[model samples]
Target: MRGYKQPTVSVIGASGYSGAELTKILARHPSVKLDKLYAFSQAGKKTTDLYPWLAVDMTYEAYDGEFDSDICFLTLPHGEALKLVPDLRNAGKMVIDLSGDFRLKNAEEHLRFYGREKPDDACMTYAMPELFHEEIRNATAVSNPGCYATSIILGLAPLILKPQDSAKVNTVCCSGISGISGAGKTAKTELSFSEMNDNIRAYKVARHQHTPEILQTLGTSATEPSFGFTFTPMIAPLTRGIYTILNIALDKHLPVSEITELYRSFYISAPFVRVREMPPEILHVAHTNFCDIHVAESGKDGSVVVITAIDNLVKGAAGQAVQNMNIMLGYDEALGLT
Candidate 1:
């Protein structure tokens, strides 16, 4: 960041889980100054009121159609960013959106998965730093990948990006279990302690919104992948972290060592992804920006399973958004995150 001025930043929807996490990170960032925090519901309250541990002395204000910073992070719900992103970009403010609003390239797919109609020009650079680093560096607006999509896409990217002809993918079936915080700050009966404490259940089976995001990213890397893909998202009892298990059927058997080496090589330059020799647990990655991945043979011929763990609010949302901001500003990709 030599010879570069500290960029001013603002966070909209700072009361939500992801937004608070982003605020915490930006408060201590060395190269940027957090200029404002906006939360419609939490407006008029100090950040310390909600997060007593945060050292920043700033009040949450309502966004008044004015962005006075060089960059803005939108942690609003789906369809909400659609209303703000266009104007922000037109005003020359770099934007990073942590919702499903601008991730899908195809408007029909966005409508089918997110249940909202997308405008013709609503798409942004899909911000998976490891996969699309250069594109994000030049993008004025970036769409952060969903929590589930982060784990599943990073787990499957190495194989999909450089597929071996002998090991053509036949099917991809994944199941993700995330902590309660991923549900946001809203209160729900099903997400209560009594309901989720000693229980876990799948909600969106095959029609999960992240399914299309996973398929879309993988398809972009390789020839339109024709393999069958299914995703089941579940909510577990905890505060943070997302664990994904992927069972992939290939045309030929691939040794675990070979797969491990491939993943290691793929994420060789990726600062936040760790290729593990043993399976990763959710607790190990809790509260961190690292995504731990382990690949193994499933004891059946031509079958391999990849396990990935990440903090849904960190690597999946806020931390990854900061990583994109670093790249877009020509700073080190892992500048403030490490």
Candidate 2:
């Protein structure tokens, strides 16, 4: 690898929260060159203009029909990346989309959940690194997981991925409280300072878009999940992080230590997932790529509760995207992440 050159990378929609975070991470990456930053609205402005703390000297430009980089990170809003991904892939540039555009494999479910029609060729490898690492490594296009989906999937993966006959999961009821940052940089009356200062409310109860995403990852379609799953997503006053609590009912009772050991052994090779002895807090993983999970028995009726914490913008969005990029580029998975 002596004569190897670092790959050039570009970011589309670089003015948003997740986009800016991705830009900062790519700027510091050792194996990739940060080339272009595209933010159509903020085009012609310097990167430091929006983020005064960044030391990089680059201007945001509007994306033309051309892409000069080997890799492209599309951090556009929900329906935007659907328009750009085809062109980027046709140009032979590796694409990583941070939107929900290509996350669902079933087109019917996509339209039902996202309320948008996607093309038939919208099948991109789902990039949940802990579960789909090998698929992502060989993928030309990857769809990053959603914030709530990331926290919940990682919390439940150990239990459902490889289930014991005696301990099959019957029901999974979980609630996720996320920071306001998960709403992105869009201005909304409901998300205003006075409205959300000391208020917390649940939105998209059973109709959350990420519900299908979580179910899809656990090896079942949304309409026909192997186990019962219910998710409630709430927005809190904090600026970052997602805290998820899952109440699971199993066919047989498993000890708290047994469940804890199952999680630890499952994620043993996963560097970013930590199995904690005590429950993790939102602050513990606010800005880091790590997903801290803790499990405990709830009742004698074969029930248990699993708790997980992660930064909504990091492990849930930008940081996980970078992890996929590293695997795709054949670099160390923890290269820029650590």
Error of 2 at 224 (Å): 1.9
Write the residue-wise lDDT of candidate 1 on 74-167 in tens digits.
Answer: 9998889999988898898889999999988778778877888988677889999999999998888899999999999999998888757657
TM-score of 1: 0.96
Q: For each of the candidates, give the backbone clash count.
A: 0, 0
Q: Which stretches of candidate 1 lie over 4 Å from their true place?
A: 1-4, 220-225, 298-300
RMSD of each: 2.0, 1.4
Kindly list the per-residue Cα lDDT of model 2 for residues 106-191, writing each as its tens digit.
88999999999998678799999999989987888999999999999999998899757658888999999999999999999999
Worst 10 residues of 1 by lDDT: 219-228
TM-score (C-alpha) between model 2 and the true structure: 0.97
